[model samples]
Target: MSIYIFDGTMTGLLSCIFRAFQFKEFDVQVSTDANVQTGLFAEVIDVASNDEHAQRVWQGLKLKASDSAFKQFYYAFLSEQQQAFQHCFNFAIYVFQQQRDVSKNYGHADVLGMSQWAKQVGREKHRMEAFVRFKKCQDGLFISLVSPDFNVLPIIERHFKARYQDQRWLIYDEKRNFGIYYDLHKVHQVQMDAGAIDRQTASGHSQSFCIELDDEEVLYDQLWKDYFRSVNIEARRNMKLHVQYVPRRYWRYMNEKTL
Candidate 1:
């Protein structure tokens, strides 16, 4: 058994595939920094990520597999589940073995698993987009904090960038300790602390984080709460359906939920 350790990026995984094919190494296992379980009998090989080698494998996969397969495989990687690399590796190998596209081959465990995992990741991405609420900071930046189940900051970048093109904003993932910032021109990933305004325990504004750039922001919060209340009918309210759409776990990040 041979264990290949990589940096846990798509390029890293593709680079491993390049090496594996070059050496005809079949009995293989993949280990990423986030998911490493060393085996006693396994010969450990450290893989250096090379974009050229990775691109060759990627282009080969595109020729051998369908576009849907390629997309699901990508989403599966983002799922970040345990052994996700293993399944993705297996699926890639399977695609290379076949001359034509076999994306709907549910008989293959790797194919089925990747498809299912992609759905889970896609659902989480949509939830992150809807649940994220930005607070104004004194620096005139719109800052939002999120701790999603999967690494979905990448998926929501385009949505926010297009929606708020004129504004400077930051969407911080507290769980991962990283954030994505857009400054009118382009978006960049940022790494920093949550800030001194740790908690929002104020009367009308209570959430995971607090930032006050403009006092008018407080009035906006109140208006949002009042709008929700005015439109809501007590007799027609359904907690079960509401919880289904906006899970209780994510309620901590929503200011309107506090009201």
Candidate 2:
């Protein structure tokens, strides 16, 4: 089997698809930087990122798959999981031959895995929408930090940008090590330095201050915690349900316990 290595971008994936078509005569294994290593007796091919090649693959996908299927594939592509990439690539090829209806074949392991990953990624996206709390900085910028299990930073940008149009903001994902910085004019990806990030206040933009909870802020936070604690009626409190709704990993960031 021939092994194809891609650059790990949407365009790079498309280029790989193009190359795969050219080498259809052989069985191919696709991989990226995170998990690519040449095995004994395997031939490795690197897929070049080309706009035209990407466009061609995109056009083919649009024709073969429904809009919903295309979106599912796109999000699955961004899952950053090695298995997800393989499943998505295989699923895309399956769609090319059998069309979007191939999803009905749930018996396939790859199809089931893709669906599970998409559901997980989708839920994280929704939670970020519901739970993100932005604090206004000294410069009138609203900022927040998140460390979502999945790379949902890119997905959160559009929602925050539209909801808080007039404000400048930065939302950093500590897990992914990148952030979205909105400077009123445009939103861009930002890399944080360890030194700068260590000095960040609750506002997330301050370079030389600790996040001090003032009396009012502390009171508000306590009120929120009280409300959260009070709302859980002991009779109806199901640990399983609570864990399902909000995972424990995210509890560390909840205002009541997040401090």
Per TM-score, the best of the predicted structures is 1
Model 1 TM-score on a 0 to 1 scale: 0.89
Query: Model 1: per-residue lDDT, tens digit, 6-71?
Result: 887889989988888888886788877535676778688999999999999999988787788888
List per-prediction Cα lDDT, in the order shown: 0.82, 0.72
Score candidate 2 by lDDT: 0.72
Residue 35 local lDDT, model 1: 51
In candidate 2, which residue ranges exceed 4 Å CA deviation?
Answer: 34-39, 98-109, 183-186, 199-223, 226-240
Task: List per-candidate RMSD values in Å.
Answer: 2.6, 4.3
Prediction-by-prediction clash tally: 0, 0
Candidate 1's displacement at residue 213, Å, is 2.6
Report the Cα lDDT for candidate 1.
0.82
